[model samples]
Target chain A: MKYCFGVDIGGTTVKMGLFQIDGVLLEKWEIPSHTENEGAAILPDVAASIEELCEKKKIAKDQIEGVGIGVPAPVTEVGIVQNTANLGWGYKEVKKEMEELTGLKVRLGNDANVAALGEMWLGAGKGEKNIVMVTLGTGVGGGVILEGHPLVGTNGAGGEIGHICVNETETETCGCGKKGCLEQYASATGIARLAALRLEKDAKSSLLRSQEHVDAKAVFDALKAQDEIAEEIVEEFGKYLGHALANIAVVVDPAVIVIGGGVSKAGEILLDYIVKNYRANAFFANQDVQFKLAELGNDAGICGAAKLILD
Target chain B: MKYCFGVDIGGTTVKMGLFQIDGVLLEKWEIPSHTENEGAAILPDVAASIEELCEKKKIAKDQIEGVGIGVPAPVTEVGIVQNTANLGWGYKEVKKEMEELTGLKVRLGNDANVAALGEMWLGAGKGEKNIVMVTLGTGVGGGVILEGHPLVGTNGAGGEIGHICVNETETETCGCGKKGCLEQYASATGIARLAALRLEKDAKSSLLRSQEHVDAKAVFDALKAQDEIAEEIVEEFGKYLGHALANIAVVVDPAVIVIGGGVSKAGEILLDYIVKNYRANAFFANQDVQFKLAELGNDAGICGAAKLILD
Candidate 1:
């Protein structure tokens, strides 16, 4: 019957959720992220909302297990956030300060790691202890949950799968200033960029040729309508995505791989393409990796953040 | 004050070591592996060795910790060897059989994983909890030690790092029946193969043209002599190796990468090439990975097998 809070801190908003120790999320909400003054009010504001909830519900503080927060920055095992660039944060003792403010134990994890944990707990990768969840949002982000624990690395940067080089001979740089990264070909932006490149190269008699704005969605939509150009674009994207997953399989050998994000809304087709390509490139022993669509979507961050403490 | 035996089961010979609980090796030896009759004599042979050791040393049965064996096969968490193709084993209850035979506790691990653990315990990667050990022997092989423990996956095939696909366009198949695996580019055989390819393409005045057999050693010796074609061959090998390490870095984010196996005899030059390429392609945050040569050499297997019991 104990309760706990899972907080997902972002650049613009902080996603929060209340959950039972048994894995049921009872409530959820969001608070505007105050990055002003170097995010000075962010922690205090979160503490205040939690304190108010405690007072209004007449719930004893001890009845709650504590809080688990997922940060956008690299967080150490002791809960020190190195720096959340978007939050203007530069090394905060998150666990210590949060515990002092709320008078409860606090746990911390990276946002992607927490999300992968959340999925392993209640979303697409349920019942699987070894899982890898790839989020194809604006950029590629992922979490590695091995034997049910997020591999928060020596420097807390273990699951940065997006930066893995997929194309070694690239001219352009990635957002991280790397060239030929997986995020360049597998992210939403990457897919859109590929579509744009295709259209620019040779869009002969293609439906995408007429669209004013060509994007990842346009490419998938074209595929649904059986457009040849779209099929080619999707196939290339699949090649990178599939190859990336295959590489990860050798290192982690996860039981399941959950695909999520804005690009994943393309649904089964995306899942099938990635899986097919992954099988072709994966190590023989890891060829049968289970592929699943992320079910929690936006709530994954909150749910996974909470799972930090649950674990 | 307690003693234990570490056994490494190989295709042709079994390496055994005697150790103290405090990580001191007192003695070591080897025995011929009998693959006849479905390898039925393997366990009995191992047990006889341990039993004889105990009696000769006059060590009390209760004073000994147990035996830990590293098998050349996938070993489940519960110590079951699914099969050792070379050993003619098919799903042997390794732990139970060993325990019953020696009248002591027993544990099991994959040979590569055990070697990695051994290296972490007392070799090149000492004091580092997160480590990835790459073995470039006849074929590429490896073991991942995360958070100071072997990551024995659900199917005990977790550390199959060699078979990870590095070249998606590879038309030739690897020994594992896969195409363009890291093993095909980084192993001793792979390096020799690359040298042959380079020699065939253009070896106008190369020193390798003098040697009747251009092996991995010949290539490295040529590199030391500053041969042009050899340098090109090494560069291509470095490119694939560097890319593979960069890819593995994001997954494990280990503090150190230890290079071992027959090909590693090239020493600093080999380490330098892999590290140079690794840094170029690594994720920005994980660019400071420490690269070291495994110090244990041929003894890694026996030491690692013994270390498994310590864990």
Candidate 2:
């Protein structure tokens, strides 16, 4: 069976996975992402590790298809990484540099977009050609796959759902310099922010006041036990995210919306809440969109990255 | 040059356009629509028009590429128009029927979606593959083209941007049985509603109080003449439409947004207001999306419908 490599570049670590061309992931590993001096060592480090793996396995280079990579940046249509903020990259022609080093074909994709492909391929969105995925971690990450193709927009910023304005009247600004973004209300950090706001509003009857770290997990746990304040916090979060998603549905009209990332572990409870709000806000014809939790977990980025080359 | 026919099926009329395969409009005409019996006469009427045109022009059937049609309905991938409400059509095999009747191939599309294709090909979004078109007439109609292809959702309900919820607390219901839909605030009727509310709220100081019919055009005229009440009403309309569009941009990230329909006749005055609000609400990368008036006007549907056959 032909082999291929999938590389996922993050701010802290670079993840690498080995897979058969038909999509059997055989092994995976990671290495430190060297962002010093404009990330000069990042690609070189990835190249070296890949070469070492090929040598150790005695796998002929001819037997491998190519490499697929996911980066934390808006990728232009021609394979230029517009900006990998975390990797300290700026307009890097990754496809060319990587191919020249490895002497193999290379495919480039935005990390969140690649993970979305992974989920569609092997996780919650499997079997669906049109789907939207929102990774609700510290911040929200989004990727829309339309007609079995990742929507790499004009500036490779097509599926940036996190910044969709949910509330225009807000005092605080989002990390992306936007105000009242969906990310400010629907993410893991956003949930905790809501939890804090609720605690401050009703300090006398709040369950979250006792927790040292009032994180999303604590809020959900409290809600599972039927805490009033926790319930309200989760409800508000769901309303913002669900409504934003409904608005998104009006554009692509995906068959499913996959919920993933650190906060999605809230699982069915979270799904149920988001679905409730989604129904109320969605266009009449698109109100029946399926909601599913991502199944591939942490392996999504690597798997999706691999798909770039395979596709 | 080869020839093709474009047909637009609407509630009151069926517009027909003859175009060269090289993207030139050769001739055009229209016929009264007969929706008297479940739209049974619609396709037959369309067939007659094409047959008569072929005979009049002495154009052989083999010299024509195919007929492209746009109907006010959700058309499934396989060519079944799910529902043509205005035409009284329900789940009709339009493509098959038209092909059989004409003895030539046929392509089908939703009206709004076809107009979007038209705008992309030869109207406002010309030369751009990704675009979103909003037609703000008595109601709002929307279509999204991604990678130059119209996004027809699972139920053929894709690109239904009019119904995206901009406010959840609204008590009044929209025609689609929803509350706070963008359609309720962004359509020509919606603009009139806003104008009425403004007149009521500021009865003592409104110029619209003197007008017999406070339609969208009247409101824009007052705004053009620097009426304070008119300005407020327009701003409110812009906010709703702009914010909703920003939410849409988070998904498709189009290069341009084309505004069409009767309301768009307000032209640059309306375009500037919407663009201002859109820039404020859109994702940063998408904030730069160009705004333009739909150039094809009444011909967009016919022109875009023809694209279905050529594409």
Candidate 3:
């Protein structure tokens, strides 16, 4: 009857979950992330929250196995995060600090990577040991889970799929100072940018022309309404992301590709366009790879973080 | 003080090596490959070869660890090769057949994959656990090694780098029935195609005009002579391979990229063009990935096959 805690640390709020070692989540909650003062109080606050929960439940210290953490940064094999722009963290020893505070072992991983792991463990990619997860939020993020483990590379930069160069002829730069990255075309913001560019280039009679704010949702909504211009925009977005994912499949050969994040709320329709383009671009032998929408939604981070300690 | 055998099953010949478990090559030989009878004779031949060698060396049965085999096809985790165009094999149980025939335990892997493993063990990628090997011969072949083992994907099609569609607009189809795959421009034959296209379009003054047969070697020879058209052709080749590799780096984040095969015979100069284009297209975090030439040459297959048993 041992239990564990999974904590997902973000810039604004920290999500926490208590679960049995077998993965039945008993309770879940959130607290404001104190990123001020270089995020010095972040880990300590998390430790105290878990301690309070155990006290309230009248649980003994030995009843808990350890804490699993998902952080918004590249994490070294030893649990050191060299840089986290959102958290104002620089070279912090996340694992050691959390262990010292809670008197329990700790496991840490990159947030997006752990989310992918969570999906593989109990969500869309359940039972798949080899899977690739693409998170299409404001910015595109990715996690490659091979053999049920995240590929944290040489500089802890493995699974940085957003930065993959999808187009070389472009002049504009990405946030990471790269030109024509997948993030420039596949993210929520990227989809909105496509709609804006489409409107500016051609004066096509479409429903999107009347919307004051044309976001990713607006584009999908327009598509549902059979807007011709929206179809073109989604097609272009599908080309970039699907082609990039096909290239990824060639290297890692994942059995499944799980699509997640804010943009994924558009639901099953998104998979149709992506799967079409993916089949056209993928290596023939790898064309059979399954595509699944992430089912755990926001809870993926916490669930995945918990799985890390169990691993 | 243990010994092992490495067998590389090729289309024309079977290359065999006897090695001490420490990786020292004791002796090497070759045997004709009889593709008759649906290649039914292949495994029995390989088994007999190993038995004869053991007796010749007076090596006791227990003195040998086992035999490792590298085949010219996609191999499942359990050592079943579903298809092999070169070997004329169809759904053959390679491991089972070999073990039954020789009465010795055996390990099996794909030829290109084991070659990548061989390179990682004692060649250019020595001591490295994460690496990507690109073989630019008649056709492009690839083997991805992560954490010191080859990435044998779901259908054993992992590391099929050649078929990654780099240009979606290409008119001519690749050998694999794909359009604009990496192999269309990166293989030795691909390099020759680039030369032919350049010579036809612009009618530029170049050393290739005087050659009887223009091939990859002729193109490199012209490049060494500083021919303008040759430089352009090589640049085109570099752009396709370098950009595709940059995309690969974004996913796997390997520490080194080892170039091999026939085109690599041009030596250090080939790496210069590839590195130039790769740096320009690579993600900033992964720009530091090192590039090296394959050191083992033809022996990579046998050496890597031996490594399978060791793994």
User: How high is the TM-score of chain A in each model?
Assistant: 0.98, 0.97, 0.98
Query: Candidate 3: lDDT of A31?
Result: 92
Interface RMSD of 1: 0.9
Find the candidate with the highest DockQ and give its number. 1
Interface RMSD of each: 0.9, 1.1, 1.0
**Clashes in model 1: which pairs?**
none
**Residue range A233-286, candidate 2, lDDT tens digits:** 999999899888888887788899999999999879999899999987887778
Q: How many clashing residue pairs, candidate 2?
A: 0
Model 2 chain A: worst 10 consecutive residues (lDDT sum):
A200-209
DockQ of each: 0.79, 0.73, 0.76
Please give the lDDT score at residue B136 for candidate 2: 97
Write candidate 3's Cα lDDT for A1-311 as tens digits: 99998999999999999999988999999999999999998999999999999999877889988999999988988999999989978999999999999999899999999999999988999988999999999999999998888888877788999988888787888988879999998999999998999999977799998999999999999898888999999999999999999999988899999999999999998998899999988888889999999999999999999999998
DockQ of 3: 0.76
Q: Clash number for every model? A: 0, 0, 0
Q: Which residue runs of candidate 2 sit more than 4 Å off their true CA positions?
A: A55-62
Residue pairs with colliding backbones in model 2 are none
Model 3, first chain, TM-score of 0.98
- Scored by CA lDDT, what does every candidate get? 0.89, 0.90, 0.92
Docking class of 3: medium
